[model samples]
Target: MNKPIYILGIESSCDDTAAAVIFNSKILSNVVASQKIHEEYGGVVPELASRAHQQNIVPVVASALKKACVSKEQLSAVAYTRGPGLMGALLVGSSFAKSLAMGLDLPLIEVNHMQAHILAHFIEDDSQTKPDFPFLALTISGGHTQIVKVTDYFNMEIIGQTIDDAVGEAFDKSAKILGFPYPGGPLIDKYAQLGNPNAFSFTKPKVGDLDFSFSGLKTAILYFVQNNTKTNPNFIKENIADICASIQFTIVDYLMDKLKNAVKETGIKEVAIGGGVSANSGIRKALKKAETDFGWKTHIPNFDYCTDNAAMIAIVGELKYKQNDFSDINVASKARMTF
Candidate 1:
């Protein structure tokens, strides 16, 4: 067997400050420090996220190393999220990884935050099996909603994407209109269980082909709530569950419709989902149903891997290390990047 490779991954791409240590394709430890401070603001403040990352990065990395029972000296390379996130947040991770790599005389590997969400499936774990190459990937999260054709590790094509607000934004924004707190996606999911998905109807946008647009749905929800609460006053309280269920169903239906189309267009039966939104119960059930309903195989990562985490970054790092794909010390964090 070849010598085991150890990669230290750092991810501060958004509000979560995370670190992980992977050895020989297996994760030893994964640590994420979530910023609860953003709750009061109803959304992430870039400046605050950066400051929190600065405070948490060191301890988070140290905690990961300790949990992994691996020391920094044994690491083979340092991997960090390079972009498609807030500039300040991305810089905190990239800069930390670069400096650590320099001090350790190790190579630096840059990972795309979006790609990390997809590559997360490759992380060695006993419970889950990785999808084969050339599979279809649906990446849905707060920032992105995309369908990708994965031909290989690091070889991916965006087959479809959202033109406006992503599905997560739809969920959160809809919840806000319902008077829910920030990070209300999970709350919507929780309330949706007892409600009727068909209780209300929202118009799905007529975006062409596989492209998606949730801005219209968001506006519709806003107007519906405005119109209903005008006379009833307690409309939201009376029908919160039904409204949430309806909204969640609408979004999931839109996503599933496009995913079915992507499968038909590509003739790829292997379907997989990633990113934070994949954790939704409704979406998970839809993907599971596709297996029997449409004769397609599906892959869903564990809940931990679904969100923005360093283990995903480490998996990509390991793949790049095998190909000798290393980034120079001068590499900088990008707020907007592709693939």
Candidate 2:
């Protein structure tokens, strides 16, 4: 039998710095260090995020290697997120991976961050929900909203995308307007549980077929608050839950509407969702319900795997490595990496 290939993966395309070791397709260790510096600013500061990655990458990689008990010489290849993220953050990971690969004389794999997100479904230990080819995937995150058609490992196409703000960006911005702290998406989700989704009605923006536009929805919320507060200054405080529920419902509804249309247009049954926003409780529940309602199968990654991580990068890297897909040291990070 052939010895399984061991690969090291690095992911510093955003606020989190991560590293992981994988043997063949199985993950051995995954370590992520997140920067909390953005809390005071109510959003990620790109330069600060990059500086934090520079400081965290070395130690993070060391920890992953130690935990996996793997040596540099044993690594079959090194993989890193190549683009579609903060330029400085992507530079840190890409540069480190390139240097390490050069020093170790190993092949370097350039993994697209979004592609890694979709491939995250294959990283789970549970074998029952593996997605087959030509699958439909809805990838929602702070930076991107895309509906992808995965024909094969390397053959994926973006059939639909956001025209304005991403779904998660709407949640975060709404949370901020509601006086929540930075990284407000989770806060909104938490408070939403205590409120009624039907308490208020928010209009779903109509952009185009298979495309999304959250700008109108966001404006609607802003105007609603402005108008209501004119009558009662404490209107938001008095009806916080209902507001959250209403916003959450609108976002989920819009996502589902686009997803259903994509499935109908593509005529594919195997559907999956990934990226940071995929971890949203409302989105998860709605996707599951859609599966039953539309008679389609759904695949979602575990909570840990749903967010930015190196394991997903390693999984994508492994797939590429097997096909002898490698990148040169001169490969640069891209700010808008597309499928």
Candidate 3:
């Protein structure tokens, strides 16, 4: 621990195969190999995703170390995502990381995928902007929708979460209803920009407190599309942009409303957002508006770190490494893990 520590982080929790080398607290290189094979199927096929990770893991890790100008022998420990993702996908990274750690006679660190998303903000960079203790983190991703209270690097409390489907599902599923390709959240954001956000209306869910429910919104959109298309088959074609804008507006508003409630309840003005949905332009704009209108400080990660990536995992690794927190080799991957 006297010298700088180099921790290699591997994340294969989903469709993305990522690896990163963190020296001390700085991320030197982060490489991600995204699986486009799932696009044709309209969503991820766990089997295909796991196989793609098997194919990409080795080269991705090698590329990250090479880009960082670091060798495997110099690493202090190996860290990997352990849960809250597909079991097969998590196994690919966890198995590889465990094997490498054993081969190198180094320690192993296990990280929760969701926790790593929130910890991503701690990755040291030129931004020099970090959320202080007791900040609120809105972790919006494909599989999760949570509002966590962060008091320390590893200490977190999920004050709010989705009661049903996540917000990302709302965006992607809504896009599917509109005939967009898989992973259509970004495309929705793109089209929403060209249209009026208030052009159409969708019923927002009435989930009380900090918990959320996007299933209602998704159902509403589906029924609306079906009902309208019955009258005019070209309904979606003629109002694609406007429909996207309105859908995006509802989702963003739902998220912000719950966040405001959390702020009022916890009295925490420092807010940070992470996960894939954090990359949405509409959500980013809403957070910026909150900063000005609600007098809150917001922390948003760079686009590169917004999705499933090892850079975030590496930062968690660094934090645990400093505290001498190492996982035993027998640690297993979990598909659904809490905290």
Cα-based lDDT for every prediction: 0.93, 0.91, 0.94
What TM-score does structure 1 among the candidates reach?
Answer: 0.98
How many residue pairs clash per model?
0, 0, 0
lDDT of 1 at 129: 72
Worst 10 residues of 2 by lDDT: 121-130
lDDT ranking, high to low: 3, 1, 2
Residue pairs with colliding backbones in model 3 are: none
The local lDDT score (0 to 100) that residue 153 gets in candidate 3 is 86
- The digit string of per-residue lDDT tens for model 3 on 108-187 reads 99999999999999888766368999899999999999999999988899999999898888899999999999999999
Tens-place lDDT digits, model 1, residues 148-232: 9999888899999999998988899998999899999999999998899999999999986789999999999999999999989
Q: Judged by lDDT against the true structure, how good is candidate 1?
A: 0.93
In model 2, which runs have C-alpha deviations exceeding 4 angstroms?
none
Note the residue pairs that clash in candidate 1.
none
lDDT of 3 at 215: 86
For residues 1-339, what per-residue lDDT tens digits would candidate 2 score against the true structure? 986699899999889999999886788999999999999999999999999999999999999999999987889999999998999999999999999999989999999999999998887566426799889999999999999999998899999999989988999999988889989898888888899999989889878789999988888998998899999999989998889988998899999999989998999988999999998999989988977899989998888788899999999999999999999899889999898
Best by lDDT: 3
Models 1 onward score TM values of 0.98, 0.97, 0.98
**Comparing 1 and 2 by lDDT, which wins?**
1
